[model samples]
Target: MSETSSGKPGLTREQLADLSRHFDEDITFSRHIRAKVKEAVPGEATLYIDVQDFHLNGAGTLHGGVYASLIDNTMGLALISEVGVRTATIDLNVRFLGAVREGRVTCRAEVVHRTRRLATLEARVHDDLENLVALGSGTFRIFEKQGRPLV
Candidate 1:
């Protein structure tokens, strides 16, 4: 799917809200690092993560684990949007390409495959300079619970 000039898909505000909620629940550090669900297509979603010192590593650089988490969350959110339900990560593979410093980062995820019980997604992390910092792929198992869903 593609984006419009506003950096969003052609979805209405309500639709965007619903899609954002699919991935917004697990994000508890909103006050420290702003997270925005920018878009959601049939099998894809984009998550924006603003950089802050709280996300830094011991070396004062952005943590690789943080990048991995962002990728995982974004990809899982994309799968949820596609499947219309909650899911749990079954497997994840991440590759770090560059360093992330003090700036905003964007994690883009696309669902590559979906089955009755599982979904696979690919994601990329880019720094504010538009440099690729990491790439990841993950699979999630769809769950049917009776309470609030995991994002």
Candidate 2:
């Protein structure tokens, strides 16, 4: 549960792609939510998810659950990309400020703090037109990995 330098370093672009594949294929819940990594590197990650009709809430806006899940996933992926390791979510806090009936939702997460024992991350989700739809922050327990998260 640490971000020790001895654990690992950020992944290469190729590794990020492979990780994305594993995310889509191995994480069953992800198949339902379907967020894709647009960028992943040291200190930062950006992810995107398109709003399908199913993603809407009863009132016809993007579901609040979608905001929470995507923000958490994107923030966690940023840590994984930075450390080239896997992490378990310790806590995730989100605030939903706006809504969109349809279009792409993007999240950008960045490492806020990291140490041998813990890492903190922050993220914001925006609609295609740049509306601030959500805000999220998380703490995760980092782990040293022998390979990809699925491996």
TM-score to native of every candidate shown: 0.79, 0.86
Residues 1-151, candidate 1: write the lDDT tens digits: 2343466433444544666774565557532355777776656788887778888888888888778778877887677655656678999999999987788889999988877888888999898889998999998998765224422
* Candidate 2 TM-score over all chains jointly: 0.86
Angstrom error of the Cα, residue 150, model 1: value is 9.9
How do the residues 1-151 of candidate 2 rate in per-residue lDDT, one tens digit apiece? 2233545567766677777777656777666888877877667888889999989999999898989888888888788777776688899899989978989999999999999658999999999999898999999888766545632
Off by over 4 Å in 2: 1-8, 145-151
lDDT of candidate 2 at residue 47, scale 0 to 100? 84
Cα deviation of 116, candidate 2, in Å: 1.4
- Per-model clash counts, in order, read 0, 0
Which stretches of candidate 1 lie above 4 Å from their native place?
A: 1-16, 29-33, 144-151
Check candidate 1 and list the clashing pairs. none
